[model samples]
Target: MVNVAKAQDETTAAEANTGVAIFAGGCFWCVESDFDHVEGVRETVSGYIGGKSDNPTYKTHTANGDREAVRIVYDPSVVSYDALLRAFFRTVDPTDDGGQFCDRGHSYTTAVYALNEAQAALAEAAKADAAKVLDQPIATEVVSAPTFWPAEEYHQDFHAKNPIRYRYYRNGCGRDKQVEALWGDQARDGIGKK
Candidate 1:
């Protein structure tokens, strides 16, 4: 069995120096791409989580109730979790339980997978703040993090590796349009702007 604490520490190379956050925000590709633009984010891995099956793959994960997710490794000294939360809120339509944008499925639902009690509280606070801003109840779930199974290698850094395709997909999906409409001037606030 893997020692989760040790695995998390090793994942970032410096246990005390690096911080990790997991987000199931619609499509993992877009979420990974967005967080990659954040200032303190050291790395982002596309993955699947909150599933009944342990070894669910790309094709079958959704059937197991897994949602596409991203695991972000960041430096708290550079970006606070609160900032990450705020950034997260701006990136997606938190009120949409039916899925995000053109993506319509349970796997496309948004969630903040809090790795600890602190994160859980922060997520809830962020959701409330977002709700206040949008004047709507947030549908995003804040739950304790479960095992994050990384997606196939081809899914990693998809935006970087396949920029043209990624751009086409993003545009066709109307993700930016929707986020801009929902968050207005603050859409993607903490990404490259950070």
Candidate 2:
């Protein structure tokens, strides 16, 4: 009953010829940073989804119950949806039962928010492929995207806007190390392998 196609169209200006992928992978800061590095991705916005409230704020989502998510706008001509899918599985613990490393909560879970039927199938296929690669069972959810409420302007590009602080926080939090440990060879080699 979830209309991902409609959500996708609303999130992305399809007439402008752009495709969007909404993903919830732990911290939005990390998620936005990851996609920012990927080629063909135009922009990544931190946000909240899969909640009961409208226009939810970070405080409301984190303090209460809501999924922390990111909205990614990209040119499909340059990067296929499959490629993004690969990156998603590689960057986060797909088998961690909704919660990502260091950040445990419904708000910090890993999820693939499908914008359409095609995206839903693609997400499932990607997860299946990842399951074959890893020993653990995949736990990443492939669900219809919820109403996205953009986070505060300060949270938009926290990494870029505050490089030193961001680096310090990231390093101190041990995110990179955990990601490497979980990903292992996949992290070193990149997430291109299917």
Q: Please provide, for model 2 over 1-194, each residue's C-alpha lDDT reduced to its tens digit, 9 standing for 90 to 100.
A: 34655554544453376788988988898888888887788888898888877878877886656788888888889988888988888888888884777778789888888888888889989889989988778888888876787899999999899888888877886777876898787762333221
lDDT of 1 by residue, 52-129 (tens): 989779999979999999989899999999999999989999999989999988999999887776777888899999
RMSD of 2: 3.0
Instruction: Write down the TM-score for model 1.
Output: 0.92
lDDT at 8 for candidate 2?
A: 42
Give the residue spans of candidate 2 off by over 4 A. 1-8, 11-15, 188-194
User: How many pairs of residues collide in each model?
Assistant: 0, 1
lDDT of each: 0.87, 0.80
Q: If scored against the real structure, what TM-score would every candidate get?
A: 0.92, 0.89
lDDT of 2: 0.80
